[model samples]
Target: MFVAAALALLATMILTIVRALSGPTLYDRLLAANSFGTKIVLFIAVYGFLAGRPDFLDIALVYTLINFVGTVAVLKFYEYDDSVGGDYQEDDY
Candidate 1:
């Protein structure tokens, strides 16, 4: 069962990578990237369980946090056009 799940997750991860590469807009690509990250976490957990390595779950959890933070940071950068902690001009509109 776990093997099947890992295989399915791998397939979906491939599809997600394709979407991220060919997405029409920035948001689409970002969403695909986020989805890929989530699938990776699942794959890690599944693989760890199948292999009887409990430590992979810890790695997966850490990756999950990183994914969430990275997505948020990217969105912030897009919104502000500045990720370097520099000042941003206020839109006159």
Candidate 2:
């Protein structure tokens, strides 16, 4: 049933969180976070259906996209910093 699926995804989300926290490297943590975000989108969609709320799906979709973009941006920042051999700090001046 949908409840069972939702529970399964919830477990996966928890696992992903652990992975993100205990990851050995930056890439590993990022991968875990990305996977968590993806699982969250699935969770929200299913939850919305079970609760008879279709509008939630739209929000989930937007969140998913934003999560993906944010992850990519963070990863890029890290990668750039690594290549530059220094931590990045922006100056608004």
Candidate 3:
């Protein structure tokens, strides 16, 4: 059962990779990348369970946090056209 699930996840991951490569717009590509990261987390959890390694769950959790932060950062950067933060305007006294 776990083997079958892992295989399914692998297939989905492949599809996500294709979408990420051929997405029409930046948002589409970003969404695909986020989806791929989610699938990876699931795959890691399943594989860890199948392998009887409990530590993999912790790794997956960390990956999930990173994925969330990265997606938000990318979106923010695109939205504001700034990697650091909002536009900066020098004060005129």
Candidate 4:
């Protein structure tokens, strides 16, 4: 049953990948990536549980935080890029 759940998650993950790949706009792609990141974190937790690796959950939680931060950063960067016409007008950091 655990493996069955994993397979279902994998199927949904594939759909998310397709959404990310074919997104028509930056926001759409960002959303898809964010969703994928969230799913990945869950997948890690479930798989780790099934494999009896309790410690792996700590790493998964850490990566979940990273994924959230990364998604925000990517969205902010894209917004800045769009607003500035892809020019380096703002602070260079």
Q: Model 1 TM-score? A: 0.83
Worst 10 residues of 4 by lDDT: 84-93
lDDT of 3 by residue, 1-93 (tens): 888999999999999999999986666688999999999999999999778885889999999999999999898887677444334334511
Query: Residue-wise lDDT of candidate 4 within 1-93, one digit each (tens)?
Result: 767877887888998899999976555677888889888888888898778776688888998899989988876777776663344345655
How close is every model to the real structure, measured as TM-score? 0.83, 0.82, 0.84, 0.80
Q: Give the TM-score of candidate 2.
A: 0.82
- On lDDT, the candidate that comes out on top is 1
Q: How far in Å is the alpha carbon of 74 misplaced in model 4?
A: 1.3
Q: What is the lDDT of candidate 2?
A: 0.83
- For model 1, how does the per-residue alpha-carbon lDDT over 1-93 read when each residue is reduced to its tens digit? 999999999999999999999987676788999999999999999999889886779899999999999999998887786554333335522
Error of 3 at 15 (Å): 0.8
RMSD of each: 5.4, 7.0, 7.5, 5.9
What ranges in model 1 sit over 4 Å off?
Answer: 82-93
Residues 11-52 of candidate 2 have per-residue lDDT tens digits of 999899999999876667889989998998999999988788
lDDT of 1 at 33: 97
RMSD (Cα, Å) of model 4? 5.9
Scanning candidate 2 in windows of ten residues, the lowest lDDT window is: 84-93
